[model samples]
Structure formats: structure tokens, C-alpha cells
Target: MPQDCERTPVVRDNGRHQWEKDRARAPRTVRATTGATERDTGLHPPDLVFHAEYRELPAPCPLAEAFGVPAGTLLLERSYRTRYGPESAPFALVTSYLVRGMIAANPDLLDATNEPWPGGTQSQLHTVGIELDRVEERLTARAPTPAEARDLDLPSGAPVIQLRKTSYDIDDRVVNIADVTLPADRTELLFTTRLERW
Candidate 1:
């Protein structure tokens, strides 16, 4: 990590801006996801590298319950890591799941190579005709596992923030679920809510 590295502040108040499209932007290695948001922390998109691993597997019990699907339902599992430059540790570890049957309508959604998908997951869902309604996120903190500590290069005894994000579609169906592990030392969460006048 660079000595000048700043904590990555995740602004929850931004709402669904990641799902919005920017037509005038040029094609680049980074897309409008977490990587794009890192710019707010002084990280340049060109210096970030994203890696994704995709697989199809049976949904675990908890995931099945969340998706309202039977156990053993096939799901597309995506593991993501975005590192700043070549020598630094990943900003965070993200594992996202989507029901295979629901997204199978679009063949490209089944492939990981198509990722860093221009407008992120929302755009991919759009191709399958699913529109997002809202997203819910739950946060917790815990000591990192040995592997997590090694991957995120955390100091001894440092804790990590776990975020579970669930996305629902227009029909109120759970469309996606993601588990994100952020290094507490380098991650910040900000949330803002507006109150309507009485």
C-alpha cells in the first residue's frame, strides 16, 4: 500500500448511482462499480486492476432461503478483487451470487469474461429485463480469519467490516446478494438520509 493511501469512504447516501449509465464515457478497463467510486479516495481508475472468478454451484442453505429458492438451486458465484497497482493488497474481497435460472436468459451473464460489465450488475440485469427496486445492506464487524488477514494485509488483531448487500427487482424478487469484506483500517462507511418537510 502506498504511504499516501487514504481510507476508502463508501457513501451509502449515493443511492443507485452505480446503476446509472454514462453514455459519453470512453471504454476503459474499469467500469462504474466500486473501482469508479474509489476515485473519491484519490485512486485513479487506470491504476486499478480488477479480477473476477465465476462458477456455478448449488446455493447454500442461507442463500437459498434469502433467494426464496429450494436448496441445491444452481447459482452463479462471482468472486472479485480490485487491487491498486501491482504491489498493493486488494481494497476488499467481494463474493456475489445470482440465481442461474433468473439470469440465464442472457448468455453473457453466465460468463465471467464479459465482466467489468460496462454498467455493472444492474446493466446486466437490464439485458434480462429485470429492473432494480431497492437495495438493503447490513453491516457487522469481526476479527479477520487468518486467510482474510493475509489477503488484506491487515495488522495483527485488526478487525474487518462485513457487509451483506441484497438487491431486489421491480417485482420485489431478490435479484442478487453480495458479501463484502472490507479492511477496517482502510475502509469507511458514510450514510446520509434526507427528511421531507412536514
Candidate 2:
């Protein structure tokens, strides 16, 4: 990672606009569905390589607090890492969590084999009658831990931007939470607000 690297906007509260545009025209179908994201965002390549895994980890303290669930709540977690190519460093590290009990109604949602579901989580939750009415993202910055640096290929002394995105349903209950790790050297965070004239 260099100090003057190009910035990539991986998340947009307005609508996953960057992802949608990329997925609409990406080539080479790979393990995960965001293959087009690399090319479309000009971050990676048309033939991006990616992998995903599922882990049942204890919910992070913040996650437990956000969902109003007990401290020991078990969370269904999906981890994904994508690279421009087999030999390239990952674009970012993403891990998403959902309350096991909340999604237990749809067994398919728990199975790793069913991942990269055609339309992603919002669509998958729809199968179980959950409708996302809003998304909120809280961001923070910190120096990368030794482990994070290795995973994201960060240079020494480089910091990282952490994003905690919470998805809420029509009933106002949180349905999904995602933690994204972006290397500061090669990433940029942008927020666009459209305000009407007073």
C-alpha cells in the first residue's frame, strides 16, 4: 500500500450503486458474486478472484449491543476476501453477521453452499419475509493490527477505516450487520448528501 494510492468507494448508503453497476456487466463468474465490483469500480480487474467461508462466532460486543441481544448470542458469520487476481492482494476484508435465530426460518440462509446468492443478503432475507427499510453505517479509524495488516496487505504504520453497517427491517429490528476493513492507504471514504434548499 502506498500513501498516494487511488481511492475506492466500496459502500454507498444511497444504494450499493457502485456494486450494482459493476455486477450488471462483469465477466467471468467466480466463487463470489462481486467479481464485477473489481472491474466496475476500477479497483481490480474483470477476472477477480474471491473466496468465502462461514463461521459461527460469538457476536461481537457491539453487535450484541446493537441488536439488543444477550451477550453470548451466537451469530452466523460469512467472511469474504476478493483480489484483482490470484496473485494480488485482497481489495478488502468483509465479514457479515446475522442472528442465527432470526434467519433460522430459512435454512438456505445458513448454508455456506448457497452463498453468493444471486442477489445477495437483502434478497436472501426476502425469502423469509424480512424487508430492509433502512441502512446505517458508523465509521471509525485505527492503526491496523498485525493480523489485519497481513490480511489486507497493508504497509507498516498504515491505518485502516472500519465501517459497521447495520441493516434494519420495516419493523425497526436489525436484520444484518456487516463489518468492513478498508486499508487507508488504498481506500477512500466518501459520503454524498443531497439537501434541498431551505
Candidate 3:
């Protein structure tokens, strides 16, 4: 999209006028410059390619169908709110996001909640997890497979969330914090974050 200023109106001698498109919005940019010698003009301007990137998450890469994750969806999730001893460490915004597909595939999986973050105190980010496509689960909320919870060994189903945290860095692809939804307002998060997998 054209992030630059709006276009200006043009008035022609013929009487009728129309808005002229700004060069900035042109997908392919070009410049014409003059030099002392005909050969003085050198390399053309380098194209500025802009694309979006999520914070600290690996580019979303697709997993398998068994995991119910879509291709190009980032799976390795890690967010941190603070260093154990210091307040200066950046606070994390990515704390209780949904669990990765690897966690969902194990045969020994038990009843699990992705981000059922503990209710009170902002001390930790408690991202809640919601099941996708009516994924099967037991009354205890464990995946039918018990071994799925064994390998990585992160408290079995309850892994102390490794969240993506505070970022002072804003590159071309930046998201406004106003756009992020709170845990209580998760119905919106489903369409944007969880349904598709990395």
C-alpha cells in the first residue's frame, strides 16, 4: 500500500482536470538525473522492497496436517516479559499465545488448554489456548496420546510460556499495539492468529 501522502489535483489548460498519481506510489520507482557528462549517470536507484515480519517469530513455516497448522505459519514461539533478576529487561507482549503443532501431535497427549492463562496478576502473560476444528480431547483436557506430552518434557502439558517480549525495534512492517486484543477479548484472536499454523 501507498503509505505516503495523498495525491494532488491537477488543472489543465483544456478546462477539465483530474488527480495525478504520485510517483511514490508507483510499485517500481525510477529517477531521472542530469550530470555534467552524458556518461556521468551511473547505477540506477536500488529498489526498496518492503515486506511484513512478525516479532521475534521465525517466518511462519507450515507444519503437517496432523497438527492442523497451515503452511507458512510460524510455529516456534518464544516471548519473554522480563529477565528473572532485572526490571530493565523488556516486558513481553507474546506471553500466552496458542501452543505449537509439535505439542498437538503426540500420541500420548493429555487434555490441554493452549493459553488458559491463570486469571489474575499481570506478573506473567497467560495466553489462552482454544481448540481448532473441534480437535478431540478428553474430559481431563489431555490429548488422547499420552506420549505427546513426554518428549520435550515441558511440565508435560504445562510449559512455562516462553513469550516474545518488548520491542523497541520498528521496521517497515510494524503493527500498532492498539491492534492487539486482550485475553478476555479472544474471540477476535481466533481469526487472526490461531486457526492458521506456522
Q: Give the poorly placed runs of model 2, Cα more than 4 Å off.
A: 1-14, 17-46, 58-61, 196-198
Most accurate candidate by TM-score = 1
Clashes of 2: 0
| Prediction 1 global C-alpha lDDT | 0.78
Winning candidate number (lDDT): 1
In candidate 2, what are the lDDT values of residues 38-92, reduced to their tens digit? 4335554445666779978787688899888987798999997776553346767
Candidate 2: the clashing residue pairs are none
Task: Determine which window of 10 residues in candidate 2 has minimal summed lDDT.
Answer: 19-28
Q: Over the stretch 121-146, how does candidate 1's per-residue lDDT look in tens digits?
A: 77778788888877788999999999
lDDT of 3 at 195: 56
Candidate 1: pairs in clash: none
TM-score of each: 0.85, 0.77, 0.17
Candidates 1 and 2 compared by lDDT, better number:
1
The residue-level lDDT of candidate 3 at 66 comes to 24
Report clashes for each candidate as comma-separated counts.
0, 0, 36
Q: lDDT of model 2 at residue 167? A: 86
By summed lDDT, which 10 consecutive residues of candidate 1 come out lowest? 17-26
TM-score of candidate 2 against the unseen true structure: 0.77
